[model samples]
Target: MRFALSAFAALSLSSAAFANTLESSAGALNITPMVTGLDAPWAVDFVPDGGFLVTERDGDLIYIADGTATRVAGVPDVAARGQGGLLDVTVAQDFAQTREIFLTYAKPQSRGAGTALTVARFSEDGTALENSREIFEAAPGFSGGRHFGSRVVEAQDGTLFVTIGDRGNRPSAQDRSNHNGAVVRINRDGSVPDDNPFVGQSNVQPEIWSYGHRNPQGAGLDLEGRLWTSEHGAQGGDEVNLVQRGANFGWPVISYGEHYGGGRIGEGTEKAGMEQPAYYWDPSMAPSGLMVYSGALWPEWRGDIFVGSLKFDYISRLDGGGVTEVEQIEGDATSRVRDIVEASDGSIWFVSVGDGAIYRITPG
Candidate 1:
């Protein structure tokens, strides 16, 4: 019966749990499970002392140190509902000295909730944060818990680039007057940058850096400080874009995807004055995390882009802008690859939400 087969499979997997490795076109990768039993971990950031700080979408912040996963206190209360919760984590460039940390989450409000960014100082013992404060809360706290695209990038200049999704409102992606569907820029203290694209414009939010994104959960800065983002489309048309200043990325106006019910969306994928995607996926991978790799680990992979796929349960390795996908790495443990980052030792680390675990990819 099916029960007998399921039991056999569980026994087989348990016996090989310690030696789980993923083999792909790249080669054999030794997969090490840093931590397990997480409630849908969203992202991970490394600290200076060989430890990791992680955020779970169910409103928990965890510290992985010396093979133990400990829940850290001081995380803000989150609207932990459908796709809304604590999402991304990042450390300050000078963390060894300042001990500052940044995170993005769905901040609860009376109207509903909105994506918000916060800054805090990590304690020395990795137990709690000090002086935590809300740095930026996206405008128009929405009613639904869907599409809070809360990815963040700490720019080289100490400024921040935060992506807020359209809050499930199809039309809001084209509305510049609100913070939804926009990449916002602000200083570390949450002050809007004077040179932002919409700073002096009327009927547009000053913090807007670029607008018209659908739900970009992936964001990263290239070596040259250029931002890149990957957004989820409705049915198909998942896109990877080179995010730029003062530019409008067509969303509802020009999508290659269709509505959930098979209806056409936008102006048929091309329109004047709207920026086209650097690349797009037709069948939809639900791309989440984005990272431009350095040659430190794989010399040939320098400048190669790695994006985690939520829908496809794989990692897509891409070339330069407008380039096609080169490869996808997948295995049983690579399910729902939510976030990807480069470690100090040059290994590629990613989180598997389906497994409630974190994994690392290194040269075989």
Candidate 2:
């Protein structure tokens, strides 16, 4: 028997109660609190029927509806340590008909823990997960508890794109034998797509779509269906990149930023065969969740990109091409934004780990 654990009282703040107006280049943005008192919430995605599925890094999945936050059952055990834990959640494209969802977590392993992907069906009542299964696990789980790049994005063709971090092992990003620091494309059942770049290649993980990322915590598709990732640099090289097929993104090899204590990182910023970042931050902001806007509510923002900042308490709005930081949506509520997404109604929603709440942003 599953239980409905009350995570917190959903504090739906009225417009008058939300005092701080967000600073933005476009205009003053209004932010309202939707839910409060969450415990280290990491990611959030909308349910097809007008609710939210939120993942807490401490291994809890909470569902908020009509001012009540209930804990959902059947989430897999996660290695909730350091940056590892229940990471990301996304509903299926045909969620109303299929009731399917995808989750990424830090799966406990013999060595330590590794990022993993799972597929499950939500119950009709939204109280429990009916069928749960692990689809993929990044190889050779390292011991230390840092750098688990675990974001899931559904491609246009219904395939899944899962991201993994280097697990603090810089050299692993260049290794073909493991899934570390790589983007993998796989089928619904965890099968490798035959057309994947590394498929059929010797000594390579067949599921890899791209490699050499440092720690891509956020990923999303643009209006044209192009995939983009927001990655963290060691000290200052935080970047946004257009992920490509089998392309090598220079990590330890070449970086625009230097070492933490200040030293040249690689041969140089530009290198042969390695892909360059679309945009980068010289002073790392620790970017997390990513979303490409459709401009349904704000026509001017169509095709623009929104990125949540974990280190800085704000959302960085990038230009349509993902090449420039055009705006910084900041306010009192914009505290340690861990995830950001565009809702069905065109309103922007984000998860704030620092505030322990979920906030909705709209044009003021």
Best by lDDT: 2
Clashes per candidate, residues 3 or more apart or on different chains: 0, 0
TM-score winner: 2
Query: lDDT per residue, candidate 2, 240-260, as tens digits?
Result: 999999999988899988898
Query: In model 2, where is the ten-residue run with the lowest total lDDT?
Result: 1-10
Summarize candidate 1's per-residue lDDT along 285-319 as a digit string, tens digits: 99999999877867777888899999889999997
> Could you estimate the TM-score for every candidate?
0.94, 0.96
Tell me the spans in candidate 1 whose CA falls farther than 4 Å from its real position.
Answer: 1-17
C-alpha lDDT of all candidate models, in order: 0.86, 0.89
